[model samples]
Target chain A: MQRKLISGIIGILIALLIGALIMLVQGYNPIQTYAALFNFSLFGFYPLATTLRNSVPLILTGLSASVAFASGPVNLGQPGQLLIGALFATVGGLYLDLPAFLLIPVLILLSMLGGALWSGVAAMLRKWFNMDEFITTLMLNMIADFFTYWAISYPFFDRSAYSPMTPQINTNGWLPIWGEFNSNVIVMVLAFFVIYLVFNRLTAGYEWRITGHNSLFARLGGIKIDKNYVTVMLVTGALAGLAGGLVVMAGPHRFLKGLGANYAWDGVMIAVVANNGLIGTLLYGLFFSALQTGSLGMELITAVPREFIQVLQAVTVLVIVAGRGYLDILIDKTIARQKARERAT
Target chain B: MNIITGLINGMISGATPILLAALGGTFTFYAGVFNIAMEGMMLTGAFFAVLGSYYFDSWLMGIVCAIIGSLMMALIFILFAVTLKTDEFVTGIALNLFALGATTYMMRQIFNVKGAFSNPGIVPIPRIHIPLLAKIPILGNILSGQNLIIYITVLVVILSAFIIFKTRFGLRLRAAGYNAPSLDSSGVSSAKIRIWSLIICGVLCGLAGAFLSLGYVTLFSENMSAGRGWISLAAVILVNGNPWGIALISLLFGFTDGLGLLLQQYMPSQFTSMVPYVATLIALYFYSIQARKRKA
Candidate 1:
């Protein structure tokens, strides 16, 4: 835990350093830019509140990736799964005329089902053909992307709106807002606790951990590896679906083209950065959300593109993944040099 | 008669990028890295190819710039995945994210444009225009007036196949993946081969990117590669990294993409655009089933 924390700090430092250099190249004051970014988020309640609202999906998708990764399926299907959720949830909210209370829950459930349906393809492929879930999920993501793009442009095309988006859901289906924060926060928090319990308390969690560590051993120890694999995939997909559902309910209330662009990949990054730990994901998801919104503020103040923040985010992940090994070599070299100097003396 | 000609011609044009990328990835696959950075590298190549061509007024310069641009990205991939020994998948994802952002950012900075750009100053690749072949019937469409990159792609695949099967370096590359420890004991450095494989992979992917922007369309667009790199990787996975297999699979993928374009007039544009992606999934099903049969 200490090492992970230290590595994360180092990763952040390096990520910031890279961002600073880019800022310098672009002739912006890096320190001032970063300061503005923090001030926009921490000093103002609204930015953080809006960030919290935007972060609900990131948190859910991170949890989704964590669940599947814990069970050893790479499950890069979050992007596709989220879109499936959005598409189905949009369909349900638009076509189904239930009371507000019932419709909201039902649309959310439909979204989860949509995610599961898509990820189920990968799970089945893995089970039947021993196909790698990674490739299968990736292929499914493309299919989902094209399929959704087609849907939004065609049948769901909102003639009422000026863009290629579905017609907004009836106001009854909107997630309740609390001040600047959307009511998605309530479900997001509820989800965190539920996932925390599942990770810490459930026997299924133990099975998933074992299956991830060693499939042969897991099988030998009476763990139902195949079933566990599929279940975890479904769980993860459901989490992603929840994210999609919440995204639509949170704002816009429509399935617009490129609604969650780069959002799915952000979740994957968070899960990996957090090492798939529930607490880690929660904290990192919050921090990531803050950074995401902060960068937008920074862009407004410093005239740096938000894309620069993306560059920083990517660098952060790379450094976090590579930091341990690189740091070990650095420490080892230092120790060796000290010992050699003492011997020579 | 025209349909056959159209399909065949479409297949070549469609498959060109995928085949190039798959062939590039095949080298890295033999060297034991999943090399998921192809998508980013190809995108980088595509962007730089256009920039270079637009500035230098030469298609060849565009291809050169692409190779160099992708090589830089590949080096970054190797620095993390090979030298620092980071998780390959994580590094790949990072590379892709960086590529997407960097290209878009640079596009805005350099071209002062967003989304896509094309200028008359940029020269597209010249077609072969084989006069004798043009006189032939339906087959003429397939044989005549193809871009130089298509012929180069065919040659690269053949050469890659030869290098993988007939060369000592190929044997070492395979050993790097299959039995690295043994290869290490035998005085061959798997790391060197892996690095070179990535460099080669980057070059191939660069050509693929160049083909996309310069050969196929003389414009640079944000995310212009449009997941073709991933599609190429899919082809690579389906064929188990065999050059010939990847080539054939890519051709099929290209054909579907082409057919989708043709089918758009008949069907909804949305559904037509989705046809290739769905085709890839179905083709993967058959490929996986074939592998299952072989295993059984």
Candidate 2:
């Protein structure tokens, strides 16, 4: 636990340094960018509120990647599942008329189902045909994008409007916002605790951990590896789908083209940076949320362009990939030296 | 007659990019590294190609710029994957995201354009006339004529196959992928071989990107390769990284993409555009099932 925390801290420090270098290249002092980002998120009420609100969908997507990754299937199709889920959620919200109490849960359920069905294709391929889930999921993302684009362009399209977007949902389905923060934050928090319990405190999580660590060993011990693999993907997909519902019901209350906002990719990055474990994802979510919220202020204050944040984000990813191995080597060498000294003593 | 002509010309144009990218993927796969960065590299190549053409007013300069840019990205991939031993998949995702942001940034920075960079000054590669073959019917139109890159692609395919099957380096590449520890025991540096493989892969992917921008559209659009890198990855996996098989599978993918374009002309544009993706699902489903059966 101590080691993981230290490594995480080190990773953030390295990311900050690289970010500073990129800022320097863009003709802005790194100090100002950091100050703006820190001040806004810490003291500014609006920025803090926005960061919390933005984290809602990210939490779900992070969980989506985490669940499958824990079970050993790299669910790269979250982007597609989220898109389809949002589409279904929009249909449920726009077409159906019901009280808020009944409408919200029903739409959420439908969205989860839509996401599951989308992911189910890749899961089934992995189980029945031994096809690589990675390729299938990646390809399905494209298919889903096409489906969503077509939906907004023709059927769901508001003809009078130039942009490709569906009509707003019935007000009854709209989630209540707390001041500036959307009710989506509540949904995200609830999902996090539920997943935390299910993954950390349950026997299912143990099975998943063992299966991921050594599939053959778990199989020999009489575990149903295939079933577990498929089940996790379904759950993960469902959570991602629920995120779609959150978008429609809690925030936007409408389905727009490109509504997923590349969150699927963002979710994967969060999960990876988090190392697919509990607590780590939440922390990474907060970190990314800060970067995103802070970028707005950075853009407002400097002629440096807000995209310097993206350059920072990209550099963080690059450095993380490059630094992880070296970190591991560093730890190994330190351990080796300690052992040698102990032997000499 | 137009359908026949479309069939031939479409296949060549479609196949050219996939062939170049997949062949690059095969080299990396042979060295035990799944270079997922090909997508990003292709995007980088496309951007540089456009940037070069825009500035120099020459397609030749554009192609050169693309290859160099892609090679630079490949070097970064090697630093992480081969030198540092970081996970390939993670690096790939980073590269894809980085490519999107970097190219978009450059596009906006250089030309102040968003989403696409199109200028009248950019030169697109022109079709090369092959003596008697240019007058021939469907065969001539399809096989004998294309941009210079198309002919180059065919040559590259043949050479790649020859190199993989007949060369000592190919044997070492295979050895490293299949059994790295064994190569280590034999006093061979697995890292060096993998690095070389990635460089070669980089050059191939670079050419593929050039073909997309310089060979086909002449303009580089954001995310233009649009998951073709993944398609090529699928081709590599489905064909098991065999160069000849890579060529054949790429043509198969190219044909589907071509057929989709033709089908769209007569059908609803939405469904027509969906043809290639839907085809991928069906083909991948069979591929997976076959692999499972083999494992059982």
Candidate 3:
């Protein structure tokens, strides 16, 4: 655990160094850019709130990726699932005539259902037809993208709006806010708590870990790997769907084109960089969110493109993954040298 | 007759890039690597192709620059997945993200463009004028006046078949996939074989990218490769790296794509744009069923 943590830190430092180099090459001051980024996004009251708000979807998506990874299938359908979920939430908010308390829960549930249904298709394809979920989910993402675009463009488009977007949901469906914080942050926190408990304390989590580590071993241990796979996929889908739902209820209050943005991909990267651990995913998700929110400020102040953050994030993942092997070699060398010195003594 | 000719011509052009990338992916697939970074490589190639063409005023230089860019991406994949022994899937995902970011960043920095970059100075690949083929009625109309790369893709498909089946390197490549340790014990380094395959994959993807920016269109757009790289990946998976099977699948996909373009005159483009992806999913479903039956 200590070694892993050390390597992760080293990986991050290396990534930052590389980012600095790139900025320097582009005739910007990396130190000043980073300072302004953190100060603008993290130190201020409003900026911190915005960072937290942005992190809500990321936390959910990161957990979604974690759950799927823990169950053996690489579910790359988070974006599609998120969009479907948001679409369902929008439909429910628009058509359902109910009190605030009743309607909000319904919208959330509908969103989860939408996400689950979308991911279920990929799960079913894998289970029945022996299709690889990786490719199927990717294809499903493209389909969902165009399908949702068509849906809002023709069927649900807000005629008064200047851009492509669905009609705004009833205000009752909006997530409650206290000060600058959306109640969706509560949802994110609850999700992390539940996932943490399920992973660390539940027997089902044990089965999933076994399954992901080795299906043959899990089967020999009398676990139903197929059932676990389906259950985990559904759970992950719901989590991702909830993220989409929250994005609508908390911020946009409507389904906008390109609303999914890069959250799903960033979430996947977080899960990978965290080594698929729930706690690690939360921490990394928040860090990535800070960078994301901060990038805007940095861009404004330094005339640096915010896209540099993406390059930084990706390099960080690469370094973390690749640094592990080299770190192991170094550790082994240190131990060997210590043993030789002990013999001499 | 004219419509049919146009459809056939569009199909070939649509399939050329996918075919090129899949041909490259076939090598990596046979070498025991699941290279999902072809999309990124192709995107990088597309961006650099435009950049090179705009600066050098030559399409040939654009192709060279694209190959170099794609090779660099492939090198990153190899370094992590092969040398460092990390998960290839993770490495591929990271590389794809890197390519997207780097390309977008460079586009802004170099051209001050946000969504896309185009200029009159950019030279597109010229079409080949086969006078003899042009005089041959419907066949002539379908085959003549195509982009130069389309013809090269045909030659590449044949050449790939020969390389995979008839060469000693092909034998080692397959061996690397099936049993790398055994191949290692037999004195040939499977890692070396995998590296070479990825290099070849990179080159093919480069050509595929060049085709997209310079041949298929005259400019580069953000994420312009779209899902063709993924479609190429599906083709590779469906055919299990058979060059001819890949070509057949690419043609089918291209046909769907071309049909989608044609149908856009009658339907909303969003619906029309979905034709190829939906078709790919259906094809994959049926292909998996057939494979299952054969196994049984």
Candidate 4:
């Protein structure tokens, strides 16, 4: 465990070094750019708040990806699920004339259902047709993107709005705010807490781990692997859907084209970087969010483009994956040496 | 007649890039590598193709540069997924992300433009005019005057069919997918074969990218490869990486894509744009059912 953590940190340092090299090549001072990035992202009040806000969807999506990955299937359908969830939330917010207390919960539930239903199609396809979820989910993402665009542009078109977006959702459906921060942070926190408990304490978590490690073994152990597959997909889909709902409710308060953005993919990256650990996902999500938020500041201060942050994120993921293997070999050799010394003594 | 001819032309052009990428993907798929980085490879190729053409004013140089760029991406994938034993899917996703960022950053840095780059200096791949074929019939109208890459794609499809079925390397490639340990015991390095397959995949994807930028559009735009890589992947999966199957599926998808383009006149483009993906899902569904029946 210590070795793994050390390797992860080392990987991050190497990634940052690569970022520095790129900046240097571009004729910018890496030190100043990085300094401005951290200062604008975390050290200040407004910047920290913005980072936290940006992290909300990431946290939910990260947890979603974590749950899916920790089970058997690779759910690349997060973006599609998120979009469907947001569309459901938008539709509910616009049409449902309920009080804030009732309406918010309804929207959330609706969003989760929408997400579940979207992923459920992929899950069913896998179960009944023996289709690979990876391709189906990816195809679903494209379909969902265009489907939502058609939905908003045609049926839900707001005549008064200039862009392709649904009308602003009812104010009652909006997430409550505390100062600069929205209540969506609470949702993110609650999600992390629940996922942590599920993975560490629940029997279902053990079954999921077993299923992911080896489904044939899981079946032999009397675990319902097929049921677990569907359940896991639904749960992950709901988490991603909740993220979409939170994005709509917390800000914008309406369905917009390209609303899913890169949040779902970023979430998936965080899950991989964190090795699908709940706590690790949270930390990595926050770190990535900070980098994303800070990139703008870095750009303004140093004339460096914000897209460099994406390169940094990708490099970090690659280094962590590659570094872990080398780290394991080193750890194994050290263990062998210690055993030899103990035997001599 | 004019509309039909235009749609047929669109289908051939649309299918060419997808067929090229899928043909490349077939190598990696047969080598048992779940390489989903084709998108990144193609995108990187597209950018470099434009960059090389813009600088050298030669389409040949552009193709060479594209292959180099794409090979670099493949090298990264092999280093992590093959050599380091990291999860192939994770490495692929990261590479895609890296390609997007790197290409976008380079476009800004080198071209001083955002979103897209195009120039008169950037030479497009020339179209081949077969005058005799053009005078023959409707077939001539559909096939003649196409870009050089279109003809190259046809030759590749045929050559790939031959290589995958008749060659010793093809046997080893399939063996690597079926049973790597058995192949290793036979003194054939499965890892080496896998690496070679990926390298080949990279080269083909590079060609596909070059065709997209230089032949299809004559420019490099952000995400210009779009989801063609993913679509190519789907084609590979649906057909189980059979070269002929890839050709057929790509043509089917190309038909939908061309139909979508033609339908844009009568419908909202969002719905029209969805035709190919929707068709892919339906085809996959049917293919799965067929496979299951065969298993039974």
The model with the greatest DockQ is 3
Q: Which pairs clash in the backbone of model 3?
A: none
Ranking by lDDT: 4, 3, 1, 2
Clashes of each: 0, 0, 0, 0
Model 4 clash pairs are none
Indicate whether candidate 1 or candidate 4 has the larger lDDT.
Answer: 4
Global Cα RMSD, each model: 2.6, 1.8, 1.8, 1.9
Model 3 global lDDT (CA atoms, 0 to 1): 0.91
For every candidate, give the share of true A-B contacts it also has: 0.71, 0.56, 0.81, 0.81
On residues A1-345, what C-alpha lDDT tens digit does candidate 3 reach at each position? 787778888898898899999889889999999998898779989889889999988889999998899779899999999999999999899888888999889999999899999999999999999888999999999999999999999999999988889999998899998898778888789878988888778999889888999999999999998898888888899989989998999988999999999898889998888889888888888888999999999999998998888899999999987897777877899999999999999
> Which is the winner by TM-score between candidate 1 and candidate 4?
4
The segments of candidate 2 whose C-alpha lies over 4 angstroms from its true place after superposition are A40-42, B292-296
Please tell me what DockQ candidate 1 reaches.
Answer: 0.69
Q: What's each prediction's TM-score?
A: 0.95, 0.96, 0.97, 0.96
Off by over 4 Å in 4: A333-345
Number of residue pairs clashing in candidate 1, backbone atoms closer than 3 angstroms, sequence gap of 3 or more or interchain: 0
Please give, as one word, the docking class of candidate 1.
medium
In the order shown, the candidates' DockQ scores are: 0.69, 0.63, 0.81, 0.77
What tens digits encode model 2's per-residue C-alpha lDDT throughout B1-296? 87888786887788888889999999999999977888999999999999888899899998899999899889888887777877888888887877877887778777777788787899987788888987786677765658989988889999999888889988899999999999988999988999999999888888899999988887888889988898888888887998888888788888888888878768667666666667677777777777767878
Question: Comparing 2 and 4 by lDDT, which wins?
Answer: 4
